[model samples]
Target: MTVYATFDSPLGELLLVGEESATAVGGTALVSLSLPGQKGAAEVRDGWRLAPEEFEEITAQLRAYFAGELTCFSIEFARGAGTDFQRRVWRAVEEIPYGRTATYGQIAERVGSAGAGVRAVGTAIGRNPLLVVRPCHRVIGADGALRGYAGGLPSKERLLGLEGALVP
Candidate 1:
């Protein structure tokens, strides 16, 4: 069974879910954006985790990311579902290091396409359920303006701000 842990971040309350492997399946909400049940449902952790590194370190990494001390994550986990295009987009998202952001058009370009592919890229990005754990928040509008954010625009603003990206 997948195990879930809840932690608080400067962004907001976050829920981390994983398998026997501690990599995350997904994380939800950010700084006042978390409404009750706003995030995907997950099993709450009230028992001991069976193996691997301390959960605290996972929590610590998340904390570090939000604090701007961390950029990339080394957690070993899996995302639940997707198509090849979606996976490609997610992988491209992973390639984006911290403190930097990419536009959907640019992501499309990276995936060997063009501005016309921005919608498809945005579609794939919207399918990102992993939140900050996967760094999906780093994707933005081509004009450097905030577009649609699943976790809410305010949280999106916070994440970009934390990463030192100027928001319009």
Candidate 2:
């Protein structure tokens, strides 16, 4: 069964979705994490359980991250969360260290999509389900300009600022 919880964060209310998983922290593997009004945000569908207690570990980790005390996320992801190509793109995104930024073309190269595939890499990054946890905001434009973010550009700027990766 699907389960969800809400977290009031520096950005806004965040929707946290997940499901049971033996290997996940708090026994629930994260499905998605979206900011308020995020594009393609996950909805609290009927029949989904609201179990705040199940997210204790996740919430703590999030708290630490927002407080600038945590650099990496240790949460587990639900199995079969995305297409294979999307997963590959996400894995490449995960390698973008905190406080650093990468260009879409760079990610495309990492995913074996060099040259014309930059757009496809951006598309997959736009669809990243885990938001801050997956660190999609670290992907920027080739000219050092902040580009599209599922959580919107303002939110993306704030996130990068928090990480000290944003230039004046």
Candidate 3:
């Protein structure tokens, strides 16, 4: 079954979703993360259960991260549904170390096609369901300007700042 939990953070309330009854390629994977007032914030569909115990470690890590007490996550994120290209893009984002930033062009290049797939990389980044856990906010514009974030630009900036990736 798909289980979810809500976590309160410095940024705001967050909703974390995972599928324990997954029969897909990845046995168990985090499916989506929703911020306060976001689309899935109020979702209470069938097969969805509130199971905070399932996310104990993850929530603790997130808490430590927001408190600046942790830099890396040891969570096992199950690779969920996505195209090969999208999966590649997300994997590239995962390689970005904490307190660092990379442009969409940089990610495109890292994924093996330099200048040709910036837009596609951005699209994949935009569609990332794992959010902060995947570090999508670490990707910026070419000129180092903050760009679009699914959680909103302000949240993006705050995340960057929290990671010490933003330069004032």
What are the Cα lDDT values of the candidates? 0.68, 0.93, 0.82
- Quick one: best lDDT, which candidate? 2
Worst 10 residues of 1 by lDDT: 27-36
Pick out the ten consecutive residues of candidate 2 with the lowest summed lDDT: 159-168
Residue-level lDDT tens digits of model 2 in 39-154: 99999999999998889999999999999999999999887877899999999999999999999999999999999999999999999999999999999999999899999999
Candidate 2: where are CA atoms >4 Å away?
none
User: Candidate 1 residues 2-43, lDDT tens each?
Assistant: 445567876566666555543332232111112124334343
Candidate 1 wrongly placed segments (more than 4 Å): 22-54
Put down candidate 3 lDDT per residue, 1-168, tens digits, no spaces: 788888998778898887774443233356777766543244657878888887887888889999988988766665556889999999999899999999999999999867878999999988887888889899999999998888888888899999889644
> In angstroms, how far off is 158's CA in candidate 2?
0.5
Residue pairs with colliding backbones in model 3 are 1-21
TM-score of candidate 3 against the unseen true structure: 0.89
lDDT comparing candidate 3 with the true structure: 0.82
Q: In candidate 2, how many Å is residue 106 off?
A: 0.5
